[model samples]
Target: MTEPGGGGRTGWVAPLCWSAVALEGFDLVVLGVVLPSLLDEPAWGLTPATASLVSTAGLLGVMVGALSAGPLADLLGRRRAMLATVVSFSVLTLLCAVATGPWTFGALRFLAGLGLGGVLPVALAMVNEYGRSGRGGSATTALMTGYHVGAVATSLLGILLIPVWGWRAMFVAGALPALVLVPLLARYLPDSRPQPPPATGAARSRNPVAQLVRDGYLRSSVAFWVASFMGLLLVYGLNTWLPEIMRAAGYGLGAALAQLLVLNIGAIAGLLVAGRVADRTGVRAATPAWFAGGALFLALLAVPLPGAGIYLSVLLAGVFVFSAQVLVYAHVSQHYPDHARASALGAASGIGRLGAISGPLLGGGLLSAGLAYPWGFFAFAAVAALGAVAVLAVPRAVPARAR
Candidate 1:
């Protein structure tokens, strides 16, 4: 890693990147939060079927955006790519407030997701590139904490504002990140990726995507994608279904929602702890353990535990579920060369979007088809177990300095 100039510039990277991702989290959860309000308005005529389609549309856009971003961020500067995406997302988000119908709202969300999807890989790449030596894993994990924080904030806003000011106003509030965060990123976010002198001729011009699978990296690259897929599947599934599953398991609606809150609280705590541990013990070592622990906690949720036991299990579940996925990102950033990091992370996440899209659908199907509360946990556990095996399968390679 290139030596950073001072603490001030280094400090801003995390917070600024975190804030950008937080906006993604906010936009992500706000749609779910406001869906009920949209449904309530007969004028909008949004049935569950149509709403599901709308949600999938946005995710489809995310997958497309994520896959496309790697090349741009690699060819362009990370800061410039991130800036363009953040601006587009913020503007589109503001436009969401003015959407009059399901089609229009869904179209806006799909467009905004283009921006949202691009930001994460670039942000992860930025954090990884700027991080100290072996701490790339830790720094990337630390940056992801912003995503969950944004989710929590959106939840609170939905509870407070969606009831009073209505759904459109809540979407309007999503635009504040642009006004507040864009300036900080524009001013301080480094245009430089940890430089180590320039390459010569064709080496400098090779595409990031093609670079990822070259030089005996194909196996590890594939493994990271598989691991990410399973991890994200678990994450999106639980986040979408946890409340309803808890409600089915006999908790009241309020308590079920509160348990979801506890889960995110645990996720935040896990990020703090996991990043440090991964840095200390290597992401390759820590990731499997995390996935195994996540699977175990999920299985624990399947048993008919007491209320406190349930809450504790949920908290522990959060601890492993989300960060395990992030460690995959960490693993990518750590394993690949600087030139390949953004593309590697982007491809992994972009492919993993399939799982993200499937997760909610899987949960909804389980919930609708019966055996939701009990069986859903088991399914998540199974997926997490697979994630463990996938990560363990990655062939260790010497880090390259192609950049």
Candidate 2:
């Protein structure tokens, strides 16, 4: 099939979209990286409570942005929307470096969250549309690897830059990539064709949100939302609290931290494997299987294992846990019509942010009660099981046009 842009240069889409996603991933972890330094500064008078408020504010903005960006993308072209979001967030993130107080910092974070939230759905939509036919699963999973790459890079940067330069430098570094990324997007990103008007007067009056429920999509839409919620819950819950939870389970701090790294490494491996399998066997089969594998591994972590056994379990858990969510995204991209694709993706992502917020709270609650070890694993296992069941409810068949 011909590429989205002429002259067979569609290669640019994946790299460009991957870079955009990496920026979002950088933002995702930057707060965690900088929070310690912020607390150390006596002048800011930053408290844990205020820090929580700032974090929550950014997430809430992301949720709102995710909810809004899809329909906006469907109405406006993807290239335009993508450029606007990137510029908006980059400028706001740069400003975060210079904020005077907690309130100012948090306000900037919230503003940046709006752009960060918009990036994923739009990028996913762009890659899916531009990619070769029948490879949506591979294309999406490949694009998402940039997320982990960005995250890992930020962690390393935090270790290196924070001690030498300070926390403010991190935000400036995060924003600097946009200087290169935005211009390339403007010059190379192809504009998707405008969505045609709905046929009937009634259809024309119905909004994109309403259309998700009106057609044969009601069941699948709800299923995707449920699956997304559970998927992100496992993701955020584990990432936020795994080290502490392992420490609670009697592991040393070094080992616990090492396991966290193992988990993400497993995630990258999983993305690589899951996408190809999904493309060959179909996302309908692969998504639930991955979730089930995640459930099994999470449950095994509850059992006391030898040192290597524990690392192996965490690694396997990471493999299934992370990619399972991305497969849900692959399914959404393959199932929805061109008009509703971005909207559906945005809704799933927006709703999933609630799970992201809830995951850390759940982990914190479990830790406070001294139940974070076995109970935490058990709880995450149950959530993974639910994700599997939720994906099963989506019909096996997608529309021919979507295929």
Candidate 3:
């Protein structure tokens, strides 16, 4: 690890990267947690559809941010970009807490989404660069695990704090981590050395996204985008509606809420483990199997199984759901050279953000139509199977060093 500042502990880098990802996780989940409270507030005047629209807007902002942040990070350097994104989202979230009306809240969330979108790719790039070469998959997975941790924490906080303090408190709580951590990030994070342009010369160096389309990379890129779409679709869908799903499946409200916790715990473990396993056996080999298992698990949930089966299904779903998308990212980082890595990651995430938006909408549509719980799980399973096959179809590229 070439310590950008000085070297005592490159160890701190992975943890900091994880912390940054945790903030992104918080931003995504907190709104869902606080939604019921927000709807009940006369001041906000949120109808169910309106509230859903607001959530969709945030996803759109995230997509825009994801697509744009990579080139910006490459131009700006990773450390400055990551810290700036953290501070930017923090301030926007604070604004969200203070805003009184729907318009203001939506606008703030959109801006916050920009910050939220930018942080992930930059963080992933940094971690991938600093992490031991053989352990890139595991290191990236560990960093991403923080996102699940934040999501789980926010869910608990919402259950505990909202009865006393209301939805604003949740946003306020969200802001605190960034405020405390931004300074630490500002001081400690190291910027990876941006790779110089390809020696093929200035003519070919124009657009990084365009570069990805050349050299047979177009196939891999499309496969990743499809896989990411399915992965995030499952993630956001479950987070948005798991409680309701559980309640419909005959669990009490308390048990329904607890299942979310159990699911995220599995996610955390999956992130920590998936990378190491992928590193040992190519990311290509590891990811398809994970998705297939996830598909089966999600399908199993739809059956009116015993209590143990429900918990087991959720735990297993969490294992594959979150890590599967991240493994796509690791594959991109490993597949692309550094100069284009961020851009590729960003594009894939940007595309996947579209899927993220759809997940909630799909869930709401299914639930509104009174589709059986099994159909929903079956649908998610289909998505997973599609993603697995999509990933498998793309021809694997040999690393240049190996080539």
Task: Indicate the worst ten consecutive residues by lDDT in candidate 1.
Answer: 1-10
Model 1 C-alpha lDDT per residue in residues 1-403, reported as the tens digit of each score: 4333322276677778888999888877888888889999888899989998889888888887788887688776677778888999889989999998999989998998898889999999888876788897679878998888888899899889877899988878998769978877777887744332355544532667877676567788888899989988988888889999988888899998888888888888888889999989999999999999999999999898874988899899999998999999999888876766777888998899999988988998998998887898999999999999999998866445433
lDDT of 3 by residue, 127-243 (tens): 887789788789778888788778778878898888898888889888888767887787777765475465663545445666567656778888888998998998888877888
Which structure among the candidates has the greatest TM-score? 2
- Candidate 2 segments whose C-alpha is farther than 4 A from its true place: 1-9, 197-202, 398-403
Best by lDDT: 2
Q: Report every candidate's CA lDDT.
A: 0.84, 0.89, 0.82
lDDT of 2 at 238: 94
**What ordering of candidates by lDDT runs from best to worst?**
2, 1, 3
- The clash count for each model shown is 0, 0, 0
Per-residue lDDT over 323-387 for candidate 2, one digit per residue giving the tens place of the 0 to 100 score = 99999999998887787777888999999999989999999999999999899999999999999
Which is the better candidate, 1 or 2, if ranked by TM-score? 2
RMSD per model, one decimal: 2.8, 2.4, 2.6
